[model samples]
Structure formats: C-alpha cells, structure tokens
Target chain A: MDEVLLRAVVPTVIGVLVRRGAPFAAAEDAVQDALVEAVRTWSAHPPRDPQGWLVTVAWRRYLDAVRAEDSRRRREERVEAEPAPAPAGHRDDTLQLYFLCAHPSLTPASAVALTLRAVGGLSTRQIARAYLVPEATMAQRISRAKRTVAGVRFDQPGDVRTVLRVLYLVFNEGYSGDVDLAAEAIRLARQLAARVDDPEAAGLLALMLLHHARRAARTRPDRVLVPLAEQDRGRWDTAQIAEGVGILQAALARDRLGEYQAQAAIAALHADARTVEETDWVQVVEWYDELVRLTDSPVARLNRAVALGEADGPRAGLAALAQLDPALPRHAAVAAHLHERDGDLATAARLYAEAARAASTVPERDHLTRQAARLHAALRA
Target chain B: MAKYLLLKHYRGAPAPVNDVPMDRWTPDEIDAHMRYMRDFAARLEASGEYVDGQALAPEGTFVRYDGEGRPPVTDGPFPETKDLIAGWMVIDVDSYDRAVELAGELSAAPGAGGAPIHEWLELRPVLAEQRTATE
Candidate 1:
C-alpha cells in the first residue's frame, strides 16, 4: 500500500489487463479506477502485497465493466481461455506493455499515445498537452486508436521495427508542452534496448543520444535555431556523445547497416569532432550515401548534398542539389547555404528569403530570415 | 508527444437560408452563444484540457520586408480567399483521435441562432522533427 509501490505496480497491472485481451480504453479506465481505490483504501488499511492487491482489484473492475456492457458471457469465455499469467521470473510485465503498446496494428500516433499513457503513466491531458491538441480531441484520438486495434491478437509477437519507430517518434518531438518528450523517448528507448537485443533500436537510441547531446547548443535562449556547424562544440554533452558513439560502434559490428544505423554512424562522426574544422566530412558524406541508398528519400539526398558540399566543394554540392527535386522541403534553404558558400550573396539573400517563406516551423523561418538579413546588412554596409 | 494546431474553417456546409447578421441576432440568442463557448472553455480548463484557444480576427496582412531604403510592403485581409481561417485551438493531446474529439466538441459550440456550427476544423500535427521521427 506504499505510494511508491502503488505507482510502480499500477503500470504492470494495466499491462496485464491489456495483455489479457482487454481493450486499451477499458484496460486504462479500469487500471485508473483501481489506482484511485487503492489511494483511498490503502491510506487507512495498507496491504502487505501491493501488486497482488492491484491485480485483484483491477481485474475485478475490468470484469465489472464487461458485465455492465452486457458482454459478460463473451468476456468470461475469453478470460477463462486466456493463458495463465507468466511466472514472475518468466517475463517482465513492463516490457510486455511496451511491446503491446507498440503493436503494429496501432498507427504510429496511437502507439505513441497508448505507450505514453499505459507505460509512461501520463494523463490523457498530459499527453494532449505534450502533443498540443485539445484534451477532448486527444481523448477521442486515443479511443479511436484503441477501437482500431480492438481485434488485434494480444499474444501475437510485435514488430520491432514498428516499436522502434514509435519510440523514435517519442524522442523526435524534442521538447514541447509540460513534458520533455525527447528525454522520455530516450528513457523508453533505453528500456526497450535493455529488454530486447535490437541493433536498429540501439542505433536509434545512439542517434537520439548523439543528437540530444548537441541540443543545448542547437538553440539560443531567445529560441533561435542554431545550425550544427555554427554550434559551440564545448556546449555539447560529451558524456552522452561518448555513450552514443559506443552504442553506434557495437551496432555497426552487427554487420547490418540499417538506415538508422547509418544515420547513427554519421551522427557519431559529427559528435567525434572537437571543432567544425575537425569534422570528418568525407566519412560523413559516405555515411549519407549509405543512408540515401537505404531510404531513397529526397530529404536524405538533400542532406547528403550538404555533406557533399563539405566533402567536395560548393560547386559539387550545387551540382548534387540540381539533381534533387525542387519541391523537396527546405530545398530553398539548402540551396541558399550552397549559394552562400559559392559567394553569390545576392542569390543567397533571395534564396534565404524564399526559404524563410517556405519554412514549416517558426524557428526555421526565423533562422532563414536571419540569413537573409545578414546578407542584406552586408550589402548595405 | 507532438503538438497540433486545430484550425476551424467556415467551409463545406449548407448555405444559410436564414442569413441573419450577428448584430441583428436577439440579445438572448447572442448571450446563449457566448455562454456556450465560455462554458465549453471552462469545462476544458477544469479538466486540464485547455491549452490555447482563440477566435482569430477575420482580417490579416501580408508583409514583405523590402530593402532598408524602400520600407515594408503590406497587403490586406483578402476578400476572395475561400479558405480563410475563422479561429484556432491549440491543444496538447495524446494522439490525433483525441484532437479530433476536442475538435468535435468545439464544433458543438454555439453559432448563429444558437445552433452548433459544426464547421470543418483542419487538424494539423505539428511537424517538428520529421527527419528523426515518423509521427
């Protein structure tokens, strides 16, 4: 009945309910009800075995809901036929919940939300705030997502790729709302990596760590975006960079170079540099080539152009840029960078302005606008 | 969690047969409409659902920074843009479905003659780190 024990055991109980084939919405609701009951009752009469108590109460609540829905017969049959709970040492309940939430049947959005709710034990409002949607809308989204995967077999093995994708999505949100989604994502990824030996997952974790290591230097206090080349290297997290590099090395030794692994390799190269001039641009460009081959995305190709510019020259970068689709997001911005390097200030200024107009985020727009402003100021001076 | 911007647009609905201007509405009807929105926001705030919701001014301007000697160029709120936004609500929801539900609730807000507008709201998942994450 201890508060810490309750918090630790609640997610596991929810996972058990979910794994037992309860719908996510129903399982979540039932688990929450159990927790509330525990808070009220345990304060006066503490239980000796909190986990056992929670499981008993949560299961009863779940059954009650089924009974209320008039599906008692069907649910009872399911419950009766369900496999016996794994012996305590046979499986980690928290990991099982992670796999269930990351089930391929759920869309990426739903998986992230469900995982955050069930595993992260975040409130729907908290999740909504993190994602920046109305609470009512978020509730509906999670419910619809649950309904979408209502028929998915809970016993089926989950796709590691999908699980990694969802985890990466969590980390990629960076920081928004009241939560640090990036850090949370890393925490989940660390948990996943510890529970499962997935090289790509490790690669993703490494990539995230490498990127996050530079986060302190990636933005100004005034919210201005700082390009990687412009970042102060001293401000980066060296310890995290070291851990990420080590993970990337181990993942590379697996002899399988997935896109994430290749990206991680490139990130490792970036993090290894003590200064901008020390960056192994040639190696970085080669890694980008590998990434481009694996993903074949225009964005990858565009990014490779930046690396190419560093490895070769501005002309080569521009040549690579010419081969890319003009409609690719941030094409103008990349082009401006190449033009700036090529000493065509007027063209760079114009492209910077166009890039600013095409920017998707406020920070991107501000960064692009500053580029244009810098050029204009130089021209006037 | 990613943040999303829910944009409400006055589009794709049956044309109003009884087109009464807002100023001409009965005072009680106007009061009812305002009360509905206020109550809706209050409910959301009470539930820790409120983030930032605001009715936008119909008017907008497009500004272009010219060379220092030339000054700025300005364009007004266009009359013919059929896709003009009416308002926006920013919420931090767990998933897209939650955003849709909140949008559905917002659509139930009172409008002309105290009827729910049910206007289309475009839900856009804010793309911050598309390169790193799929969602």
Candidate 2:
C-alpha cells in the first residue's frame, strides 16, 4: 500500500484491536505484523478496502498469537467466538487510544512513546531511534506505559491539554532520529484538531509550523545557534509562515483565549515582520501578558521580559527579570542577553560564562562559551 | 521500552602492555581514534538511538550527610573503590537484543593506537522511576 494510505489506516486498525480488549502491547505487535503484510501484499494488489483489510489481518495475527499460548479447546473457542463487527456509525475509537497514550499515569517520555506507537503507528525500533534510545529500552518503556494505562475505558475521553502537551514535546525534540518528529507531531496535531475541534490544538500546530518555518535560518553551515533576532529572514519558509498565520487567524476568531493561542499570536507577529527591527514587540508583549495569565510559567514570564525590552527599553526588561527566580534554567543566559543589549559587556561576559557552565546541551554550551570568548576578547582589545 | 545504562568502567581491564607509549603513535592514528568516537556519536544521532552520553571526571569527591545537628562531611576521591566509572550512556531501546547490538557498537569505540577497544562496558537497565519524565 502507499505509505500515506497505510499511515491513515493503521491508527484505525489499532483502534479496533484496542476496543477488542487486546493489550496495548499485543495490539501494537499485531498491527505491525498486519502492516508488514500490507506492505508485502498490497504493493502488488491494493486492497478493495484498506481499513477492513488491516483490521482483518491484524485480528487474525492477534488470534494466532493468542491461540499459540492457549489450550486447543480454548483457542478454538476464541476463534469461533469473535465479536460482531463494531456497530456502524459509532464514535471513532481512536480518540480513546490518544487518551490512553496520554494517560496522566505515564511519564511524558512514556506517553510520547505510546502515542507514537498506538496513534502514529510507528514501530518500537522507529520510536526508539526517534528518541535516540536503544530499541530495547524504548520497547520496555512503551510496554510498561501500556500496562499502566490498560485499565482506561475505551469510551473515556482524555484531557485535551495532556494530549497537546505530549504533541508539543514531540515537536520540540526537533529532527534527530531517522524520522522528523516535528513533522510527525504536526501530522498528529492535525489529526487531533480534526477530532476535537480544539483551537489550542490549532494554535499549537500553528506555533510549530511557524517555528519550523524558521528552522532553515536558525543555524548556519558551521552549526552555530543563531538567536531569533539575528536569524536571516530571507531563508524563513514563507509557505509555512502563511499557513501558521492562517490557522492562528482562525483560532483567534474563536475568541477563546488560550496559552497556545497567545504564543502563536506572538509567533505570528514575528513571522509578519520583514526585518527583526520591524517586529511588533508591543503587540508581542501584549500577547505574552495574556500567555502569562493562561500559564503562569516562569519561562513565559522570562520571555515576556525580552519582548518588553524590545518594546520598551533594556531597563524595563531588567526590572521584569528581577522578579523571577534566580535558579530557573537559562536564567543566566537571558540575563546575559539583556545585559549585552544594555551594553554592560563585562557583566554580560561573566553571565555568559555562567550560562555556558549551566547549559544542558553541547550546542547550547558552545554558543554561550563563544559569546563569553567574544566579549572577553573585545575587552582585551 | 527497556532502558539500559551502558557503563564505562575504568577498572579491572588489562593496562596497555605495549612498550611504546601512546605519544609514540603516529598523529594520524590519534586523529583516527578521535574520528572514530565522533563518527560513533554522529551515527547514534542519525539513528535516533542516543539518549544521553557523558564523559565523567576520573576524580570524584564523596559527600555524606551527618547527624541531625551537624553539617555534611566531604570525602576524597575514594582510593579504595575498585570499580570506578569513567563515563556512561543511557539508551532507551526496544529489546535486550537491540541494546546488546548498540552496546557492541559502542564497545568498538576507538582506543589507543586507533584500535577498537571491544572492552567490557557494563549494561544496566535504569529503574523506571529514575528516568526523567521530560524528554
């Protein structure tokens, strides 16, 4: 079968197996087997009904495994006792899979893995590679997560916020493994937005598209981390930016303000600017204010301070920064940036060094270290 | 998804018995060794198989909390310890077999003289709770 058709059908097949009370792990295996068969068989002869074909093949695979482990009599009984086809026109069961995958019981990593497995129809190896973990370790984490949420009712709806959070995490990982998680996240988010009609999902999808659109300009061939203000605007993906803006406009039309919508608004403002100096920092700061109300996260507040600095002045940004906790991750980096903008090169250089020490990733540390080196060299000159 | 910790041990391995010191190796050999490690990391990144990898300082200071009214006591590099960890990589993989496969690849990371070490790197599965919830 074509890859796109398979991707669309696999989740529906998984939903059927899950509703049949197949354990998440077994259902996943069965679906994978069916997908393999589909790839092998369907390439030469496309199925008349792809979803039905997948469901039938997957059910048989599941029963084959179950039969192998059970007594002959029990196996025969199960095979003969297959439940009636799910009633037509019933609510789609895939949403429950989304909820179960996002079940609060599972940790974020587990939740993301489960979502990719069950909803995205990705294999354990594929998921493991995407997350840069060993296939075995990722497999165990996914299985454990499935067991944790095995009790979730099929009909129960899951928290939209939780599901969105998982998708956000997936998008933020940026492309690392064999797959582009950012694209996968967008695909999943589109599925979710269609299912739930949630504006925040749209908002988040828009935000991701907007950010991804700028990815080309975010780094140079030498692998340096270019801050947004310094990024080459010409390289930004205008198509993605336009799509994001369109989605944000629709979401904003709903008038139900959300954290994601506010953030998307800010991203949209940035995308609209022809040059960094032309950025509407005043409107961006206003949206940040809305975002701070929606999600009282310190990171949001810290970001708002940067916008405030751009809209108002460096002193105003510094004053806003003073109110936040000193130990927040990247606090020193933000301070360094603000001080550097304020022309306190000495303090900026010192904080840059401090930030470099606290940087969590090699690229981030390298960037900060470069800042410190540059400033220190300038001082010597 | 099982989690495996690939631990690098700085102990219980035969010391290099070659009469020539590492410094005597051709510059190209040393460059090859560094390239091997860099390539290994790049491969892991491409495969989306790396979780977290770090090189640890050989020297470690030990600190212990004291009784209720006292400050914690700090101790030294603990010369008595036999199995010191040089570094480690935590990988989340799909099965024990895949973990072994990756570990086998990691074991081939270049050592002195640009040769694959193939040394024993202990593989331990991290307990689930210890894993950070965030990616």
Candidate 3:
C-alpha cells in the first residue's frame, strides 16, 4: 500500500472532522488512530477510494472515542448527538491544515512538531526520533501544542509568511535519523504552492530545492564539510537544480522580490555556474543586497560581505566585513579567507584556528581545522 | 536533530559505581556484557538513532613532522599519562536529556557478577552544519 498516498490524504480527513465541529485535538487524534489502522490493515484490505475510506474510518474512530468516554448514551443518541459529518471534500483543506498547524500563536518548535504530525502525517515517534528528543518528551510537546491550537477557528486565513517560516525551519532541520525533513518540507511547500497563488510559496520551494540539490556534496565521507569552493560539483543533483530554477524564474517574474526569492536567485546563480570560479559573483552580490534590504538581517549582511568580496576583490570584501560586528558567527572564517587571499597567510592561519575553535558543527570544525593546518604547513615550509 | 558522541574510556572519567575491572568478571559475564552492548546498538538502529560506532585497538602511535626535509618523528605510546578512549558510539537524537538517557542506558550494560556496570560514559555534543550562509 502506498503509505505516502494515504498520508497525503490525512489533512483533508481531519479538516472534514474539524469542519463538523469536532475539537482540533480530538479530530487529529482520531485521524492518527485511523492512519495507524490503515498502515496495519491496508495491505490485506486496500480501499478502492482512499480519501473516502479514511474519512469514514477517522470519523468512526472519533465517535468511538467520544462514546467510550461515556458509554451511557444509547447508540442511536450517540450517532445523533455527533455533529453531522461534513462533506468528504477535495484536497483544498491541506492548505488550511498548513495554516492551522503553523498558527501564529504556537511557538515555532511546537508549530513545526504539530505540522509534521497533523499535516505531514508523521507518527509522534518518527517526529521525536527526527528531532532526537525522547519519545515521551516529544509526545508531551506535541500534545501541548495541540491543546494550544484546539480553540483556533479555521475559517479566518493565517499569515502565509508564518507558514513559510515553519516550513523553512523544517527544511533547515535537514537530515537526521531516518526521515529527511528537508525533503518533507519540500513536499509540503510543493503542496502549498499548488493550492495558493502566492509567489513566496514558490520562492520557498525554489530555495529548498536549490539547497537540497547540493546536499550530497556538502559533506565527504565521515561527515567532513567541503566548502562550496572546494566541493565536487559533479555530485549536485541536476534535476533538482533545474526545477528550483524554473520555480524561481516564475517567482521573480511576479516582481514581489521577497527574501526567499532573493535567496533562491542567489542559489540559482551558484547552481548555473560550472565551477566556483565561473560563479557570477556580481549578480550574487546584487541579490544579497536585495536580501539584506528585505530582511535587514545581520545574517544577510554577513553573506553580502562574502559576495561583495568575490564581486569586488579580497580587500573590498574585507572593507565590507569591517562594517559588521566582529562577533558574528563565521566572521572569523570569512576574515581568514579574505586575509589569505590578500597575502596575509600568518593572520589567516590564526583566524582559521580561532574559527575552528568556535565552529558549530563537527564537519565545519574539521574543515576549518584542515584550513588552519594547511596554512600552518605552508608557513613552516 | 542533535548528534552526540558516547565515549567509553579505559581511563580518566569519574569512577563508575561498578568499579571492578573487566578481567575480574567470569568469561560468561564478559560475554553477557558484550551481548548487551551489541543489543543496545541494535535497538538504537531500529529506532533510527544510531549513526556509527567503533572500538579502538589497545595500542596507538603518535607521529609528528620533523622538518620539511626530514622523516616524521614518532613518540612512545604513553599508556600511563594518556586517557585511553576504548570506543565511541555516535547517535543523533532530539534533546540533550535524551542523549543523557541513552548514555545512562549504555552504562547499565552487564559487568562483573552479571550486574549493571553503571560505567561513566562521557556524553559529548557533536557540532552541526550551519543552516544559514551568514551564521
């Protein structure tokens, strides 16, 4: 049985229940129970109509839970007391599910957890494992998040940016455990893009694709990071890059110029190049400028400095970097690179070592350490 | 997800509650300990938490560059001063608490008299890739 296909229908089934006046948590729980049953029994009894089957099963399960809470009522009254079942409905509710799960009231982590379960149709255990939290902790977090959102009305639309932010967080989680959350984020983004005409959704999808395309070459065996300039570009997934570029082109045509589109455009510029030397640094610098203005983010400015260094020269890059706080993360690494380019190998080596000490990830630390080692070896020779 | 290293040390960590040397254990007790460890790893794999693990050989060599034109220099294996890392099991999990829980479980592997060892396994967080271009 195509579990993904079954999972894809989950939001709509829950939406049907919620529209029928069922509490969001109770309806979500019912749908999840139905999903578990589906996974177990679908191989033996595959339904001809998956959505219809799920809606029936989930609605029935919701009733069963309610009835079991107090079996004092006659079966006829139980059926009558229940809200009339809403129409089985089209796939349109998936977008609503996204908005509900990404509701502004929920914390980002809680929203992400809720979305992965209610919309992404992931098991609590799977989500917990993906995040590295113990199953019990994740369960409490998810249940708490659900309780918070239980009262929210689904009719009023939510801010699309909030939804995008949640999806972005999911994508940024990248890969760990068994699930590729990046891929899951892309899947949800694609679903959102299909339902909404918002260019930013396309922008987000484009950005995710562009980054995901280079995932294979991001690290070497044993998870040692290979910096962009040194990565073997042959490993990049061409198909994903093409798709991202296509989506980006359409978003750019809208002329909205959101932060995501700008980031995607920068990524596209890198992807279009045959090698690091071939990258259009000038155009990338322009996009970074656009991104900096849109978000006014320190992170964007930091990236802009790097691009500026490439577009202008190492000295110009250093000049741009000088405008920012030296305490910013990776500032030393960037400084080290620009210094090495400007013929200050001794200083570069020192900064590289410093950067290595502050490195956030194992691979990044190893990469910076290797850079320092090479520079030190050069000095020794 | 956060990745962590669970380091089993031959020395240096705080003394375990079960402080008896492995050599003191019966052969069957040692076998049971190994089996428990293997099963622990297997369970982590089935749960999608395992990344990798390895056991170090007892001996190791330290080398250094002498000069550009000279052969590299080698030093004596300092078994006395050195803190021997017996092995490491890497796991990717959601929270620091979860990592601690796993470490606690690993330390419970059977030891002398086939009772829980309570060995002090060092739990260290692994650094992660940058999510943004700037930070």
Interface RMSD for each candidate model?
Answer: 6.9, 10.5, 7.3
> What tens-digit string does per-residue lDDT give for candidate 1 at B1-135?
436688865533334444455688778888987787788777756544456778877678889998888979998767776776767766655566777888787767666777775655688866553222211
User: Model 2: per-residue lDDT, tens digit, B1-135?
Assistant: 456789877774444333234377788877886677678766655444467788888799889999999999998887878878888887755567888998888777565666776677788765432111111
Across A152-189, the per-residue lDDT of candidate 1 in tens digits comes to: 66556677788888888788776856777887788777
Pairs with steric clashes in candidate 3: A131-B94, A132-B93, A132-B94, A132-B95, A133-B94, A361-B127, A361-B128, A362-B127
TM-score of 1: 0.73
lDDT (C-alpha) at residue A96 in model 1: 65
- Worst 10-residue lDDT window for candidate 2 chain A reads A81-90
* Candidates arranged by lDDT, highest first: 3, 2, 1
Tens-place lDDT per residue, model 3, A158-272, is 8889999999989987776787788899988998888888899999999999999998888766766678888799999999999999999999999888999999999999999
Models ranked on TM-score: 3, 2, 1
Candidate 1: share of reference interface contacts reproduced: 0.14
- Give the least accurate 10-residue stretch of model 1 chain A, judged by summed lDDT: A81-90
| Top lDDT prediction, candidate number | 3
Error of 2 at A38 (Å): 2.3
